[model samples]
Target: MSRKRLYLRAGLYAEGRSDYDFLLPLLNRLLSSLASSLFPGACDVEDSLGIDAPYPAPSERAERIAAAIADRRAECTLFVIHADGAGDPRYARQSCLDPGIDAARRASPDVVTVPCVPVRETEAWLLVDAEVFRPWLGSDAHSALPAEPEREADPKLTLGRLLKVKEGRMRRKPERLYRLFGEEVSLEALRALPAFQLFEAELVEAIRAVARSQGWPR
Candidate 1:
């Protein structure tokens, strides 16, 4: 049997980091923003698969997730949920958040939940980081840049192609792209994207709310 893991100061949840590479850095950025006043100790995210299997039967899914979390209730203070906006982000993200919140509550009623679903997909937010894209574009960064990345229909495809331009034959696999963002890209550049804005605002507020509850200054 696995030893009982002592609880950390906090934690986060995402669908699959390998499948959605950008989300990890994005989540980390939020932690950086909140670390000083909100999460003083190390706070990290784990793929939800560790808690429950991917998309179990609808009837059993929530119960399974709740049970899993209850079994490991000591590992987190709250769980920030990461998902994609399959159709309409505002509406679609809730599909995951509602159930996730319920599941977390089963483990601890006070668990705070923050939901993020980049418009269309998280890749959509990356496209908006034109400062980083400029390096890839060489001379065409200004001209090749899309003015409305959020309006794009298939951002994942668009991002994959853009990444290839920087790397001749390499695909936008998780490690490669995540490395670029972590080591090369400028986080400030992404603030222009609406998806990032939403995430920033929601995360700031969530952290503030938690701070208030803990009687920490806002």
Candidate 2:
């Protein structure tokens, strides 16, 4: 008797507009686009929760999301999305799963977890960007820096140093995503990268699988 529902877990611990700069918009677009392509709008997509604040901890974030879903009192499919960082992605996922697991045991199984490629998984994207800025750095790309700068210097040197100096900055944040792509590139670019695309495609499949398992929409 309840309408079908879909839950999206987004990661927003980065610079730029939390949802757009991070993963929510992309995930929503992918799921909606895929659903329309496959089912031609036969099903409706509703969010169980919207992320409005910065969460200090993933477990707390997961708990808040779980509470929102319970308040809806609707049967739904869940998809959790997050970037792997210094914190354990597995722990973040397990934390999200705990509440859903309990909910499912008391009700029905409808939650699925998918972890995206770590910075290591997408190293080529970083290498590509580095090569673009390398020429301007010249020998300075590897040179040691003065303790402090007295005057303005080349911008490329600053970027080169960031790429070399910050061991994890380029790797961890969602903003780096734009660095890999040209503005002209369509959303398809993410789908082109097996490292990036597979995670999303598989996530959709997981949601579909859960929905089917719940006997939703026949």
Candidate 3:
């Protein structure tokens, strides 16, 4: 009997450059967990294509998605698109993610696309786990976090207030802070958020679709 080998290649189009620092690690962790459960005993390899530049205008998103698909259609099995649900989650999904994903699917029907639209902003997701702040703020980290952080109008501002540093002390850069939060934040807490739950469900379905198409053992 031969052991099966599975290669999972993912492409990420983040809304901001700082998002990569957080999302890359978060996505990798999710993939690792999924692979362990879904393809136990198989040799699983993972790769990712990161889009680090500024997001294109909404009008250009479809063309950009199609071009990205064309560029790595052979290697990429999944594409995760990030769009901040600022003010209106519905509008963001319709205007920012749906059209692009539809166009991409039309061009490369085999590839699976997942939308990651964090309510308000990605910072909202980081606010769910208060323990993630202890390392930076010590006992003073006991500030009250929002009950429903996703509904907060400006989660970034709220996070900044909670993590404020004293004058003359150097503050951690946003990218590094986001990466730290990503690595340490509890996934269980994240799942409590409606937006995160939706994203995770879609991601799981996308992975299952890819696995079925590839005939990889479940």
Please report the candidate that would top lDDT against the real structure. 3
Give stretches of model 3 more than 4 Å off: 43-47, 52-59, 140-142, 168-170
Q: What would the TM-score be for candidate 3 when compared with the true structure?
A: 0.89
TM-score to native of every candidate shown: 0.72, 0.44, 0.89
- Candidate 2 stretches with Cα past 4 Å from truth are 1-21, 46-49, 52-65, 68-77, 86-108, 112-117, 120-185, 210-218
Sliding window of 10 residues with minimal summed lDDT for model 2: 146-155
Q: lDDT tens digits, residues 1-218, model 2?
A: 86555333322222124323435544555556666665563556553333322344235554544443444334345544443322343464465445443543354344454555333222222222323334334565334332222121332344334554344345434344433322222355345444456676766676566557556554
Better candidate by TM-score, 2 or 3:
3
Error of 2 at 115 (Å): 4.0
Sort the candidates on lDDT, descending order.
3, 1, 2
Clashing residue pairs in candidate 1 are none
Q: Where in model 1 is the C-alpha error above 4 Å?
A: 1-10, 37-73, 165-168, 171-173, 182-185
For all candidates in order, the CA lDDT equals 0.59, 0.43, 0.79
What is the Cα root-mean-square deviation between model 1 and the actual structure? 6.1
Candidate 1 local lDDT, 26-53, one digit each (tens)? 5555455555445545333333223333
Q: Which candidate is the best by TM-score?
A: 3
